[model samples]
Structure formats: C-alpha cells, structure tokens
Target: MKWSMRIVMTLTISLVIAVCLSLLPKMDSSIGINSPYHWPSNRIGQVTDNNLPDLLVQVPLQMRIRKVELSSTRMSLDLSLPKNADSTSVYRDLYTIAQTMLMKTKNVNQVWVRVIDYSGVSDNASTQLVLAMVAERESGKDMDKSASELSLIQLEQELQNRFRITYTSKWQQRYPL
Candidate 1:
C-alpha cells in the first residue's frame, strides 16, 4: 500500500508539472510579456493608414528625388535638380506632381517641396536641404492601389533612375510627422 501511494504521488506531481509548463506561454501572452507567438521584427504588418513612406517610394518622378516623407495629412519631397535644369521650373513641376498625387486621396491635405542645389558645394560641404511639412489629420478613407506590384528588375531600374544621389549622402529630417 505504501509503494502504491508513492507511485500515485509521483504521477500526480508529474502531471502537475506538465500542466504548468504548458500554461506558461499562454500566461506570458495574456500578461503582455515576451511570447513565442508574437510577430518578429522583420515581419511586415497589415498595410494600414500609416504606410505613407511606402507609397511615396512608388511615385514616378522625372528628376532625381532624394527623399520623401509622408503622413496622414501631409507630404514632403527632397529633390536634387540637375545643374542644367531651371530650379524654379523644377520646383513648380515637382510641387504640382506631389500635390496632385497626394491630394487625390481624402487623407492628405497639403504637400511641400524642397529643391536642393548641389552645384558649387565642395566635396566635404553639406548639401542637405531643410524643409518641414505638417498637416492636421482628417477622418477619411484610405487610397486604393489597383495596379499590380512591380517586378524586381523594374524596381531596380526605377531606383537607379530616380535616386542619383549615393546612399551615403546625408538627408535632412524635414517632416514633422
């Protein structure tokens, strides 16, 4: 009888330990601690109302666009105009393009443009442009993308053509949002 009691106690203790180990992960998730089921840092979330930067990179441009920043209500662009191009005309064209592209959706209210002139600056001199674009958030529906995704080759070509500036160049933090 004592041997039987000892066997029964050992089984109960093992079962209790197994149940507790199984419940540990669930308890961690419920309490908002580090959980195994949580999303990894590299995993992209759903395309929500905050994916303006992704959209900006897809916009077609004639000149070399350095940087783009967008928010729920405002958008900004930094462009490096060619030495031969007219700065005023380039600015007007870029501003119009940005305004039209962004204002088509009800979410954006304003667009800002900054033209960076890298004509005579020394190799060590800074050529970063400073500009800010800010707008109040509006309650509106998101924009729809009916077009299919571009191929890797097409994307690479677009990047090579659009971004003439090197990746090591410094860019100003212009957008407030």
Candidate 2:
C-alpha cells in the first residue's frame, strides 16, 4: 500500500512537469520571447526586398511598361511611345494609368511616368508626368490642374519632342512628402 501511494505521487509530479515543459515554448512566444533553439533567425522575420510581392513584375507586364522602379511610397515607370505622340493624349494616358495602378497599393502615394521614345535611346527624348496622391484623392471637381501647369507640361513635351532632347538619366527620384 505504501509503495502504491508513492508511485501515484510520483506519477502526478511527473505529469505536472511534462505539462509545464510542453507549455513553456508556447507561453514564451505569446509573450514575444523567441526561443533561440526553436526559432531560426532568418525564418522568423518579415520578408526581404527580394521576396516582396510580385507587384513589381505584374505592373510592368500588364501595362506594357518597359521599366519600373518601386519604393515604399513612389514608383517610376518607363514607357515606350512613338516619337511624336500627342502631349495631351500621352499625359492623359499616363495619369490614368498611374492613378489606376498605384492608388490601391498599400503605401504608394506618388507615381512618376516617363514616356520614352520607341528607339530606347537616352538622347532621343522623353516626357515626364508626376502624379501626387493628394491630388488624385480629391474630388474630380477640385482636381483640375491650373491652366499654366497644364501648358507647362505641354510645352516641355513639345520642346523635347521638337529638339529630340532626352534626359541623361532615365530615372529620377522626387522629394518625398
């Protein structure tokens, strides 16, 4: 009888210890403690840039875009256009594309579209269109660009087209808001 009692007490103690040991890891994780033995450093964190969502590839392919560079808040696109494409039409198309593609992205608030000549030569000519998130979000009634602003973009496009001027660099970063 005495031996049986000791065996039962021993079993109880062993069961309690087993249960506690099993729960230790879970408790540590719930409280934000990482166990070095169980958690691998590389597997436990956020994905790096190389593994970012496939938006980078999908955006260019879907839009017939030539090149795309994306950061947290801004995206720059290189689009191939005919040598003498109409400035207004090009701007409209670029604005529409930028708005549609980027507005829904989680953190993107601005898009820079560069209309490059079909020749793909840096010296040929390009038109740049920059769209801001705030302006895009505003009601259509309030979203109109000033006449001068519209004319300025048009003029720049015209000058570049006429002179076959191109920027030395295809991509330029705009100041962050």
Per-prediction TM-score: 0.36, 0.35
Over 1-177, each residue of candidate 2 has an lDDT whose tens digit, in order, gives 999999999999999999999999989787653422232222322222443333344322222466767676656667765544444554455544443433434445555566654444555354443321222222212323322355546644533342222332322332221
Residue 170 lDDT, candidate 2, scale 0-100: 26
Error of 2 at 65 (Å): 1.5
lDDT of each: 0.47, 0.46
Candidate 2 off by > 4 Å: 1-64, 120-177
Predicted structure 2: lDDT: 0.46
Supply every candidate's count of residue pairs whose N, Cα or C atoms clash at under 3 angstroms.
0, 0
State the RMSD for candidate 1: 12.3
Q: Name model 1 segments beyond 4 Å from true.
A: 1-60, 87-92, 120-125, 128-177
**Clashing pairs in model 1, backbone N/Cα/C closer than 3 A:** none
Per-residue alpha-carbon lDDT of candidate 1 for residues 1-177, written as tens digits (9 for 90 to 100): 999999999999999999999999989778653332332233322222344444444545556767667665555666775656542344334433443444344455555556665656786266754322222223111222211244434433432343222322222222211
RMSD of each: 12.3, 13.7
